[model samples]
Target: MDSINVSELVERLGSDEDAVRKMAVFKLQGCVLDPSFADVFILEDGLTKLRHLTLHATGNTLAYSLTSFSRLLEVDKGWEYVNQDLVERVVELVVTHPLVNILRGAMSILVFIVSHPYTASNRISQPDSFGFRALQPAMTVYPQFLEMLVSRLSSADHALCANALLLINSLMREAITNDSEADWPKFIKQLQDLDVIKAVYTLMQSTALQDLSHPLIEFQALTKVLLRKWRDVPVDLNKSDHRRALKSIHLASNPERVTTPVDDGEEGSKKRHNPEKWRRLGFESETPAWEFEEVGYLGMMDLTEYVRQQEDGFPKLLLEQSTKLSEQRCPIARASLAVTSILCEHFEIEKADVDDAKIQLSFESRTNFDKVFKPLILQWSLLHTAGLQAFFRLWQTTGAETEDFMKIADLVRILLEAVVGGATRVSDVHEVETEIQQFELARLRHLQMELLELTYEDHWGHHLGQMRDELDHEALQFVKEQRIRCLLAGAWFSNGHGHKSDNVAVAKQDLNPSNPTSQRYAKLAHNRRFLHYADFDVRDDEEPDLEGLVEKIDLTTVSSVVLAPSEPSSSTTTLKATHKFISTRKVTIYGYLLANSRPASPKIHPRMGSTATKTPRKEVTLLTLHPQTQSLAAEWLDGLLMLLNYKPITDETKRLIAMVQDYGLKIRLLNVRFDDMALAGDSPEIPSREGLDEDYYYDILGN
Candidate 1:
């Protein structure tokens, strides 16, 4: 379609006769699909003409006009012509239009506007831009829009249903990308309120649809966002309402497993015996040892070890049943597992059930249940904060009243009590004192084991009794130590800070301790009294001694912690020179308390017949943590960061801190806070302000 043809059709769009206008719009819809048609249409001012049709035109005229607009808007530059008024009219059409074609056309225009990268970016950076203005009414009337889409998901028209799913998928993708950190949780809650999950799940199960892939993909995406939102939002343990909110979005129950009959042919036999297929289904391969040797040494060794480990028929059966319970291929099953994985990740479980199924299925079994459930019970007893939150989220999501899940629930309650008790013990002090000593490790161990063993009368009980009888001192001691560490770390990070005596030793490098950095310590010139009054005095001969002063920073008042720049002389030196002069690693602690100048003595000096001012002045304090070793500096830096950045005072923070501590302890670091620390030498240099105007400097310097 040339510009001349587009201009001719556009002129006919304003004709007095209704038939001529309708024919012009229908033909223009096809023309607008051409890339060059948008420019000529814009030049002809066709958007303004289409805006009129959208508001007044009905039936095919409105639909075709919308189609033309939708196509024109596909061009990146076309968004500049869209305005808030046109968007409102299209949204109105979406709400009041009776024909499915008109509604879909309007929605298609919206989808193009919203999902465009340029428009989505502008939504945040330039809220008053055309794209954002267009989105306002659509967002305002989103509830009705969502309802319409949900209703269309159940429509008998396959094309309408698919379009609805496509629109929904696009909207969700945009929401996840753009609004994830903003209003994503609210958006997710809205989806739940409308039962979009139920509708989508129903659509997935519909056999009338020739291909289930599109709906399945949409369902998976929805599940991903829900799981992501749930993980992002922490649940308050103290609030019953917060815990109850997790149960609001119930996923469809897991589909029952059914065995399909096999054909009595060579192909059927090959399918039944396929090792790769068995592995994909989460089962042990039936391939022979010779076949394993054909792979390689590493593969053969791995298979050999796995096969040897599952020698017992009972254990093999349990593994097979557990694998079946997880059900990898089903979309609903994968979603359920994802929910479980999110719970596990939040809880800080050491080994989460990612794609592989674990012993979780054992909890559902009644026959020889204790044997199956014992390991998991013991593992849960030693869980970190993340693990506990995982368990809590799982308990809430499943709403399971089963004895096994109840055990997790009970563990959560007990852990909460421990946290509260820890907090209560330190409520009187500014910092944790003897609370670590006060916590009876043995009693806590016994309590945890008691809780974990409550549901198990057979295997766990008998196993403990046998171990006691055999006097397995080393094994029992190991378990006791692990349980104590888990409980104490969980409780301490949840409520208590480190011990008051737990100060990290550091050296002050910016100024010598013997000569205080405070200006108040500077000697005053008695001869120049006017200069002293003007705060510009020369130093006197006699300097007040501050040789033995010791500086100690109380970390509780620290507002920010930042790494200080390392000296270029040390960092850029050759290997031998670098060894000779080791770089001094430092971290700056900013706090109001640290800003107070050192107090001067009231006693007069005999030589000058005067005393320095006793009053302290407030200034920006830069207390650098200078440790002898890099690792020591990293340890303190990480600890201060974790301390300063900790907020919201929720159970989730407790679990995370506990997880860090647990991992650090396992690795045998100096402290639990030694995460990966970036060297200040590697940081980018700040841009110098040499070319700035004098006024800019004055503004910055507060002149």
Candidate 2:
């Protein structure tokens, strides 16, 4: 294809015809791809034209222009063409573009410019050079760029988010690997000030990346460079205390509390009548007319103030966000847990840096552990069973990734031991109860006991032994003895640890099968009234029997009650009494009440419809009833719906609770019928069927 005229194409870029402008951009893309042609094009001021199109063009036109501009740097000596103006224009495009492709293209050009081998060193030492001018502005506005990228990482478009991550990774790689090494420390400190580390950590956690190998590698490298202690660098206590001093000054000078008080003439005249005032007021007094000393009164720092100053910083934000995110079951939940663990680990390692011989954790480390890890553990105990199981699974899978996952494994181990220790604290039981609310304390106590039972096996016992080897033997022995005492007191599994058993075992009565009393009891049990479907033949005989072949249906199998099957084909198959019984697995059973039965003994006949061959078929009853049974049928349907909706105390319910409390799974109860209404000291009331409305006890048998 013949190349378009450079001057004409440049003019055509501003043409009213969109097609001519796109054709000009397409020709420029071809020119930028070839080094010889790119040099000629740059001589013709093509870079300026492309930058204009990148800013003013809309949609794919802007995206294509960005791509062409990025390709200019693929040639040797391409760094000379870059300048501060071009950098600003590209950054603006990156920040403002609504389209992902445009954003990606702008990010690519930015990364390409920033990652050039000459850009970092030249920007620091030779600020007047072209490379320096291009790169210095990018480094200056990095915090804003970082915030934008972090926000993009949570974007719904995964591909756009991936591009954003790639750009960040490129910047991090350049920052750490630059050979100048002079300004790297200052740059890293700036990154920390922007909270880039925490933001990236959060982004990585919340994203749905299938394979985190690349991003994790980049993050681990960044951490190794950024998390280290600065050698021989003295702490700048002046900068650290600047914020507090400003706050204090602002408080002292606040006009709301420091207004000048005006004296009324009556009081002034009365004071002037005194002898001392008359002697001092020769009209030339050394003291001021009104004392303003009260305005300068600033109180000394109280205990609460000191604590608030310490707690109101980044630590507080971390604790609050981590607590809230830990209870969620999204992909980010584990990441949140992992990041919290890493942060706590970093603090511990920092505290230990002061003393080489110290094996015990410093007070600061212990305090941070309590702040970051304890609330998360407590919240997890209440809500997330899936998270707990995933934590344990990660611990088990840490062998292949020894260095990578060791911190996570250690944190989980510490949480488990802490739970056990807290549960078995006999001396602090009363104090612990007093510190928190009664309800939360009881919940914590219950969770601790449940976890103790779950962790009593061989794998957990081995883990405990490993933890014991790391701690002092005397301390370990004391904890073990306390655990034994708690277990023997029946407190580990039972709610009431201090209460005595009410009764001993009683003797069992023997049943004589031949006795009339035993036979009568057996007959009653066998003939008990259970709601069921009675199947019979649909022969051309006179009428179907109301009581024929009956099959029992467990009320627990019923998940929901719909008015009828939604199948349009079956809408005309029955009368107005049609209803359905939906199972937990979503199997639909169509049935309606018979119209000829007695009111006391309501009967239901199965209406046949769609059936899956794999499902065990419920027997279809062919019964007919009188018109009076319709009301009884409606009552039975309403009662069954109500009963199915009520939460029951079955083994499945117990298993679900255990899963949530012990495993941190995200299972929640769907049918919430009762609240924890009983007071802490009230006797538990047993529910009975006597207080129910009339519809609840509709008899299904004509005994």
Candidate 3:
């Protein structure tokens, strides 16, 4: 590879043959890789020739030179020369065409100019240039170079904006790692500038998750020196949040990872939001090791904001901007919901954070749910529903994940709990109903005034009153319908406490929300329409389990038939209808059924997808415990039998108890009362008692 003469290389740039010009530039750039060679290159007006070609270069030529420049800057210390006039002209060209033209070599020039050590450092205390001289003149012009980049970032094509982010990230990664922290504050301030933040966010907003590694990953890293409380960060959570979110490939700083502390919580710890507790919210037992860049975490935080807007804000421009970007509702639904569900158990998230934006931040943007719920619950509800739809869409699109099922359980419990709590909160249920009707009318009147008009000239007062009256009637209808449903559902689950951290019963449900059985129980118990794909056994005319289960009798060799199956059919199996046995809280029995019987009346035909094998297989049928046997179930089962007043297990019930355990109901329990009444009254602590052994009991898992 013989290098070409610099002057001849300069002239050949305009040669009729593109390959010749490309080869010439490639050879010239290769020669310039040495810092010593920069002087010679500058000697023959080489920069002028390079600039000429940059303005007219085809992708192949430009890509070669631009890539060469990035490499050259890594080594060369003397090539930061551009005549004042030429630098201004080129910088202006980049600023103007940077946004509109993706392949016009503007990015290449910015890359070249910004690579100089002058503009690379923050304005204050810039130590030196590439060659180690503190040349104030060179430093003076540096701001202009960044200004050009900022302009491009603010108004460029989305892809170009992505490139601009790449440029900044590249610089940031290197500087944060090796450079002194003296100028870090200014640099970070620059980073948060609207121009810069918008560009980075747009790139993140546009990237396909399948290709999360493209460019974003290449530049992925944590700003080891953050503005607030950078110290004492949990290394594992940092590593996990980063890996799961960013899929980061490069880290600027290899900060030592810290072990998340495990706290054996006491009464005081339970009252506070604990980091250890958040880790406990992992869909499973342990936090798996995964690392991601800070950018991914930041992007996810933004997603929470998007959720807030979708659920409560509904700003016309924010939505319109999203549409213009063609995001296809992902930000509204999946991205935000993923964070919300995770954050529900994620560290630092208090219930207060949900509306105030403390954990995820939006309060400064002025939309805290708790503070403004009375005025904006409906507006927020609309956005929340929109966000919920997006979450479903995202999860559906991604196929089922382990966490997906757990999240499902949490969300369902939350939904039901909200309804139940609303029902129980006010005394004099009928008056509460009347007030709800009035509230609906007031809300409707407010909406009418905003969306349409009760014009002043056209019977304004009368028209306004009519609209209010009409909605008032509709409000009454809504309250009536809600009351019927909530009355039934609330009494069943004992209201919103189901989703609370202290709610033992529903919290247990969170472990397996997506399980087909749980979904089945939820639908049947609530009498909500059949949920996605569920299969439940509801038989009460005879014995509940035997009624729906198909039983086969083989008088030949079989002494008894048993069954065990789980989830829906292999595909498209819907939960069978389940009828509730009672309107009030019924003490359903669970544990071993010691009774000896001949005909398991409704011969269980066996659930469709049996985990049991062929031949004479023992079966496990999931059934509700009858009130008569509930006490016996409690006696026979482990601590799982808390709800029922029953005696201890007897030898007679051991076999039946083992059968019940397989269906996943051996949960921790206590005698703490969490019925709907508890929610409307004062929050009281349960008195401590020497808990029964875990072999069958708990210390109040009350929510």
Backbone clashes in model 3: 37
Which candidate should be chosen as best, given TM-score against the real structure? 1
Arrange candidates by lDDT, descending.
1, 2, 3
Number of the top lDDT candidate: 1
Clashes of each: 7, 14, 37
Candidate 1 structure, TM-score to reference: 0.36
Q: Between 2 and 3, whose lDDT is larger?
A: 2
Which ranges in model 2 have alpha carbons more than 4 Å from their true place? Answer: 1-18, 27-52, 74-77, 119-146, 169-207, 210-216, 229-703
Show the lowest summed lDDT stretch of 10 residues, model 1.
491-500
Residue-level lDDT tens digits of model 2 in 1-703: 2456776777777778778778788777767777777766677776777777876787777777877877887564355556676687777766656788788778777767755666477768645433323555664665366667656766676666666766776666666565254566656656556665555544444424333324433454445343333321222224434336324522332212223334664432222222222112111123321121211101111211322343443233333333432222112222223433333343332332212222222233422222222112222212122223334344334422324344443444444434423542122323332322222333443454455434433324554455434433433333334323321221001111111110000001112222111000000012223333322222224322224323333332222333333432223333222333222111122332212221112223244221222323222221121112333323333333323332222233234334434332111111211242232235578788786777656568876
Q: Write the per-residue lDDT of candidate 3 for residues 1-703, one digit (tens) a residue.
A: 2455666776786678889878877776667666656566667766666666655665567655554544444564324443344344444544444324432344544444444544444334434422212222433555464556655555435556555555565455445544554454356556556355444434343323122223333332232123111222223444455454322211111112345444766433223333322122121213422211222333344343453444434333233323432322222223333433432332222222222222222222222222212211112223234334434443344444544554443443233223322432112333432333233323433333332232221324454455455554444344334333432231112221122221112212334332222111111223332111113333223322323323222221111111112222222221221123222212221111112322232222245321222232222222322222332222212222211111223232344333333222112111222252244445657887677555865588778
Query: Mind giving the per-residue lDDT tens digits that candidate 1 earns over 1-703?
Result: 5435777777888888888999999988887767776777878888778768866788888888888888887765467556676677777776666788887788777767666664467767656444333465665865486676667777776766776676666666666656635465566557657777666655544454343344434445345444444444443424454433221211111112344456664343222222233333222332222222222222222222332333453233334444543332222112222224433443333433322222333233333222211122111112222232334344444443334443444444454345323442113221222332243444544465554445332334554355444444433334334433332221101101111111122112233223212121211122211001111123334433323113334333333444554322312211111111125454444432212343223333345322323453222332443445544444444433433332212233334445544333323222222121212124546789888867643345555
- Ten-residue stretch with the least lDDT total in model 2: 516-525
lDDT of each: 0.44, 0.41, 0.36
lDDT of 3: 0.36
The collision pairs in model 1 are: 343-390, 346-386, 347-386, 347-387, 348-386, 348-387, 385-655
lDDT accuracy of residue 628 in candidate 3: 26
The C-alpha TM-scores of every prediction are 0.36, 0.33, 0.31
